[model samples]
Target chain A: MKITCSKSNLVKGVSIVSKAVPSKTTMPILECILIDATTDIIKLTANDMELGIMTEISGDIIDRGMIAIDAKIFSEIVRKLPDNEVTIETLDNLQTVITCEKAKFDIAGKPGDEFAYLPIIEKEDSIEISQFTLKEVIRQTIFSISDSESNKLMTGELFDISDNILKVVSLDGHRISIRKVPLKKSVADRKLVVPGKTLIEISKILSGEAENVVSISYTKNHIVFEFDNTIVVSRLIEGEYFRIDQMLSSDYETKVRINKKELLSCIDRATLLVKEGDKKPIIINIGDELMELKIKSQIGSMNEEIMITKEGKDLLIGFNPKFLIDALRVIDDEEVTIYLMNAKAPCFIKDDAESYVYLILPVNFNSAA
Target chain B: MKITCSKSNLVKGVSIVSKAVPSKTTMPILECILIDATTDIIKLTANDMELGIMTEISGDIIDRGMIAIDAKIFSEIVRKLPDNEVTIETLDNLQTVITCEKAKFDIAGKPGDEFAYLPIIEKEDSIEISQFTLKEVIRQTIFSISDSESNKLMTGELFDISDNILKVVSLDGHRISIRKVPLKKSVADRKLVVPGKTLIEISKILSGEAENVVSISYTKNHIVFEFDNTIVVSRLIEGEYFRIDQMLSSDYETKVRINKKELLSCIDRATLLVKEGDKKPIIINIGDELMELKIKSQIGSMNEEIMITKEGKDLLIGFNPKFLIDALRVIDDEEVTIYLMNAKAPCFIKDDAESYVYLILPVNFNSAA
Candidate 1:
């Protein structure tokens, strides 16, 4: 295969597919990126069995051919090329020559026939969503996904779509995060669980432009996302997600509206007294027009108070500062309303429009004894 | 101890002493910073067995007392305090209360008597050097210090002073880097091996300003650096340094003058073809007016040619690209002169004034067969 492409275009294409490249595997071929240049446009594909990504590059195709080369070396070479145009040609002995300016690189290549093709899904039931909204939803919920591999279902996020509204939910045992966004058109209702890793990679690829739209198609065991010049296919986890709806409640005995920045900084300051590997929790006491945050550890104790708007009974609760900080950081609103049933019940953070909801289980201070 | 100081000043003092606090040691007191407020100026000190740092902070002394607090927690608390005056008071039970704005912190403290004191060094054998020059010399040679613990002496740099000139040398097994700078006035000749870790910390503390001067004094076993409002004392490495002067020579069969930027970029590009754990060398073929760099590995080969000015016989040699890149990155000159004896001998890089010298041993490529 012979082709001439701009250095920037090739670098972008290679980086997109490199996200799916297997880091280490017994099968050497899995580490290679398949380059198919049989058509007018060159296609680059990488697969790690569970996830596959493909991107296209616009180039001048001299001859129709295909080859697979190491993803890391190709990425680095293309990124460092000085000239604007790069010429790539493949020989019969499975060796590829990359020439740019006065520099030339000959890299060993493998036959493309041994590579596995990405699974094909029929686009009968596809949904369209705004790229900006999808990216925002992923950013809001992905952090709550469980990092432990012991619970496979908790490692994925549940995608629920119905009546033109898309809801993305992620939950570990400690907290639950949900984001609800509206679609332009109504579509068939569907539910699927996608691995958190795949959503993380796809989120990075999206440009987050309000005008750009992404078309998503899914089957029983696989899902595909098509946007810009890239297509990503990932395997779906086969298990029922946690019934988080039962755990979320709007009824609360205490409600307070506080400035997001002020509260976040107060909690951050209180966390300074906490040591690594120490399971100490920061206690929050909500009272009339005021809220106090406190943390006491073996080495030190800190307490800070901030003015707030309260409308219900006073309450005191303890929670891991990191959990609250993570939720607060992603929130863009200036003021956030917190709902608490009691010191023993889980607290909830929700917008007035019910667009986003965050539920965090309180840490029982009695257990410290 | 009772003292009221600006948050910024307290933060800076705490951070400087925190660097010398032991991270993991059986002696718990070594991890604490002693705060003395008996005098008009408050003093903060932290010491590990090998290194110690102390800084004076001017503040209002409410009462005369002293205490030691955990460095990690104290640093964090002072850093996050609001922009206002901070009042720190010690109780009879060794408990400290730090109040700033509306935030208050209660930290557990130990008796100041348990903290180790920094050894006093006599000022008779002292030398003064420009802070800027000393910082520059340390940065230029510190990267070559051995990271291995097997050869303790190689982990330190040789500080040799004579005729009002200070020369610093560092080397691992493959290369040696040296930098020489002149002092303002002459003093007693001294040679000592200072641990690289101590130099690194002191370099961070230096202001690197031409007008600022650093006074250095040494004893039989310890070295002390006094600059600005900080003092750092460290134990000298007890051993004879390598005789690197004999390894440097002016005799050469080939000499070439080339643009430093161009050579560095070329070698960096060639490194892309190399994989981890691969001991491949980049070969430079110096001919009449052209230089060719080539790298061959199991995966592929890459070669590039650049123009150069030759003053001696043509030659070819192989060396690790990283070693060359390290030395070239630190040199401020646009053009550099490289002297080579043969393909088997080490190459020397020196400036016109002989202020800096870098000697790199070539990798034996024949062993790959």
Candidate 2:
């Protein structure tokens, strides 16, 4: 293979595909990135069985051939290349020569046929959404996904679409996070569970710009995302997602509207006295126009209060400070409304329009202390 | 004890003394920062038996008393406190109450009498120097200090003063680096070996500004640094420094004046092919007006050339790229002159005025391969 490209363009292409290279594998070929100049535009591809990424880079193709190079070494070389036009060509014995200005490197390469290619996904069943909205959706729900390897269903988030509304839900037996976004156009109803790790990687790659749009599609076992001349494909988690509709309701005995930043800071300060691996819960006492938070650990104790607008009966509950912090951090609101049924039931932080819903199970303070 | 101070001032003072707190220690009290409000200005201190640091902070002392609190917890609390005046007071039973705005924390504290204070270092044997100069000295020579704990002498740098020059020298078994600076006035000749770890911490705390001056002093077994209301005392490493002057020679068979940046870039690019823990040597071939650098490994081979002005006989030599890189990275000159005797002799990168010197031992390419 022979090609000429600018250093910046080559570095960008290599970095995008390097994310999918298998870090540890028995088959060495899986750690290689296939460069195909035979295509109209030069293409770089990496596949680790579970996830695959491909990007098309603009370069002058001197000859039409293909080869695979070690992803880590090739990426480092391209990044450190001088800021000028670079030429890459194959020599006898499958040796690749990469030169820029006065610097030249010769590395061994393998035939592209030995590499695995990304699986083909039919694009007929797809929907378009702005990259900004998709990134926000992933950021709000991905944190709640269970990382346990033994339980297959909890490691992925459920994607359900119907009635012009798309909902993403994640639960780890301790808390449930759900975000819903209104669609611009109606499409066929579908449900799929995407692995949490894939969504995290995708969120990092997404530009998160309102002008950029991504097409997402699903098959029986694979999901694909296409945007900005790049394609990402990952195998779907094969299992039935938990049924969560019955657990979510509008009924509540107590409701409070408090400043998000004020409550977040108060709970954050209370957490200073609690040590890691210690289940010391932050007890909250809700009353008329006041909410006091307290925590007493082996180290010390802390107490703080914030004024709030309350309605209905008063309530007292205790919760893991981290769960509250996580939900509050992702929320972009001046004030959040919370609904509580009782101390034993789940507490919900939701919007009246059902745009976003966060349910956290309270901890038994007597036992946790 | 009771005191009110701004969050920023308190945070800075706590951070300065917290560096002396032992990360892993059998004595728990060593991990605490003692706050004494009995003096006119509040003072914070921490000691790990080997190193001690103390700083005075501006505050309003409501009462006269002292207490010791956990450094880690106190620093975190002060950092997260609201942007207002923070009040820290001790109640009966040695309970400390810290409040800012509406957040309050009650933490346990110990009697300050149990805490170890910094040793008093006499200022009779002292010299004044700008903080910027001391910081620059540490940055240029600290990288060459040996990190291996086997040889105690190699793990520290020699600080010597004679006539009007202050010279600092650091060397491992394979290489030596020396940096010298001219002083305005001469003082008594003295030599001391400061531990590498102590210099690293002192460098971080020193503000690199020409207007700020730091007073450095020495005792029988301690070195003290005083500046900006802060004092740091550390035990000196005991032993005799190596005799490196006899090995430094100016006679050479070949000399080359090359662009410092160009050679550094060439060597850095060649390093991409070398893996960590791999004893790879980069061979240099110096001819009339061009220098060629080459490296070959199991993976592949790389070759590059840079233009230079050479005087004397042509030469061939090889060296471990890392040792050359460390010295080259710290140099501030645009162009450097190198003197070489032969393939088996040490290479010298030095100045005509003897302001700086770097000697590197060459590798046997035949055995290394």
Point to the candidate with the largest DockQ: 2
Q: Write the per-residue lDDT of candidate 1 for residues B100-161, one digit (tens) a residue.
A: 97799998899998889898776558888889988999999999999999999999999998
* TM-score: model 1 vs. ground truth: 0.94
Q: Best candidate per TM-score, number?
A: 2
Model 1 regions more than 4 Å off:
A275-277, A367-369, B275-277
**Candidate 2: tens digits of C-alpha lDDT, residues A145-237:** 999988888999998887877899999999999999888888898889998888888888899999899988889999999999899999999
Q: Which candidate number maximizes lDDT?
A: 2
Evaluated at residue B359, the lDDT of candidate 1 is 96
Q: So what's the TM-score on candidate 2?
A: 0.98
Question: What is the CAPRI rating of model 1's predicted complex?
Answer: medium
In model 2 chain A, the worst 10-residue window by lDDT is A120-129
Model 1 C-alpha RMSD vs. true structure (Å) is: 2.3
* Model 2, span B1-369: residue lDDT tens: 899999999999998998899999998888999999988889999999888999999989999899999999999989988889999999989999999987899999998999988887765577778999999888989888999989888899998888867899999988999999787776888888988888888888898898899888898789999999999999889988998989899899999999999899889989999998898999999999999999988777888899999999999899999998998988899999999999999999988897889999999998644
What's the true lDDT of residue A311 in model 1?
A: 89
